[model samples]
Structure formats: C-alpha cells, structure tokens
Target: MKFLIDNWYLVLTAVISGGLLLWTSLRGKSAGVTTTEAVRLLNREKGVLIDVSEPEEFAQGHAVGARNVPLKLLSTGEPVKQLPTNKALPLVLMCKTGARAGRAAGMLRQQGYTQVVAVAGGLAAWREASLPVEKSAA
Candidate 1:
C-alpha cells in the first residue's frame, strides 16, 4: 500500500492503459491479416479484393484487380451494390492506411459477411510485399 501510494501516477497510468486495451478487444475490432494472408485468401478462396478508398484515391494506385467500394457507401448501413451477391464468398478489404478497411470489415461482418478481412497494412503493406498495383483515371 505504501509503495502504491508513493507511485500513484504509475498505477493510474497502468490502469488507464490496460482499460484501453481491454475496451479495444471487447469491441471486437479485428487486428487484421497480413498481406500474405490476404493473398492466400484471394488465390485459394477466390476472395474479392475490395478497395474501400474513395474513387480518386483508388485511381491514384491500388492493388491489381481490386474492386472499388468506397467506405461511404458501406457506412450507410444499406446493402452495397458493388458487393458480390454471394455473401459466403471471401471478401478482402483494403484502404490507404487500413483504418477505413477495418471499419469497413466490421460493417460488412454485421451485414452477414462470413469471410471478411482487412489487410493489416493496406496498400502500403501490399506494395512493401512487391505485390502488383495498377493505376487509373478517376
């Protein structure tokens, strides 16, 4: 008790840090999969690579064969027209930095997508892996 009292700030910091980690885990956010796993899903499961970046961002550079489905359309809570009709099909999502893809993954999971996953590092990681990328006009 005396030690804790002397180091009250340390205890409080530890508590806050632990609480944040617990909250994040309890919220069911995915830690996301590596680029290698994403590729395996794409090749083995015939997963669709859905780039959640906006059209302009996607046009700048994106994974080869990735279909554009902006996060805005997904966040509306309505059925996304661009998604595959077969909900059971694997869906691999990515964005510029992966944050939007994570949010999009949660949204898709709520919509009954059984095999949805986000790339851990998004396009940057994909590029780092020397994966193919394509560019287009917006």
Candidate 2:
C-alpha cells in the first residue's frame, strides 16, 4: 500500500498501458482479409469482388471485373438490395484503404450475408501488387 501510494503515477501508467494492450489485441482479432488472402479467395473461392469506392475514384481505376457498389449506397442500404447475386455467394468488399470495406462487410453480415470478406489494404495494395485494373468510361 505504501509503495503504491508513493508510486501512484507509475501504477496509473502501467494500468493504462495494460488496458491499451488488451484493446489492441482484441481489435486485431476482428481484422478481415489480407491482400494475398483476398487474391486466393478470388482465384480459389470465386469470391465476388465489390468495390465500395465512390464513382469518381472508381472511374479512375479499379480491379478488373469488380462491381462498384459505392460506400454511400451501401450505408443507405440501397445498392446492396440491388445486388444481383444471392446472399449465400462469397462477397469480397473493397475500398481505398479497407476501412470502408470493413464497415461494409459488417453491414452485410448484419443483413444475413454469411460469407462477407473485407479486402485488407484494399485497392491500394491491389495496385501495389501490379494487379490489373480497369478504367471506367468517363
């Protein structure tokens, strides 16, 4: 008790650091999909790739054969409802850096999609890997 009282600042810092470490581990477990894994899913699982980038960004360049759903449309639940494929098909969600894709994946799972995957690192990583991209007609 005396030692803790004398080193209260150190004790507080240690407690805060431990809490942050625990939070980080928990957060890391929820991360979905890496670029390599996503490619495997594409080739092996035939996952349907859905680009969540905005129209303008998507027009600049996007994965070849990827369908654009736009993050805004997904948030509003309109685009997903219009998706042609059945919900059971494996769906791969992708965006600029993957943050939007993660959100979209969670939204899809909540909507009863069983096999939704977020493409980690998203189009940036895809482009970095020299993968093919298609330019939209302006």
The TM-score between candidate 2 and the true structure equals 0.76
Clashing pairs in 1: none
Residue 53, candidate 2: C-alpha displacement in angstroms: 0.7
Per-residue lDDT tens digits for candidate 2, residues 1-138, read: 999999999999999999999999887756667778878887898778889889898899899988989877877755464454578878888888888989988888877788898877888888888888889999
Best by lDDT: 1
Query: Cα lDDT of all candidates, in order?
Result: 0.93, 0.83
Clashes of 2: 0
Instruction: List CA RMSD, all candidates.
Output: 3.9, 3.2
Off by over 4 Å in 2: 1-26, 79-84
Question: Candidate 1: what lDDT?
Answer: 0.93
How far out, in Å, is residue 98 in model 2?
Answer: 0.7
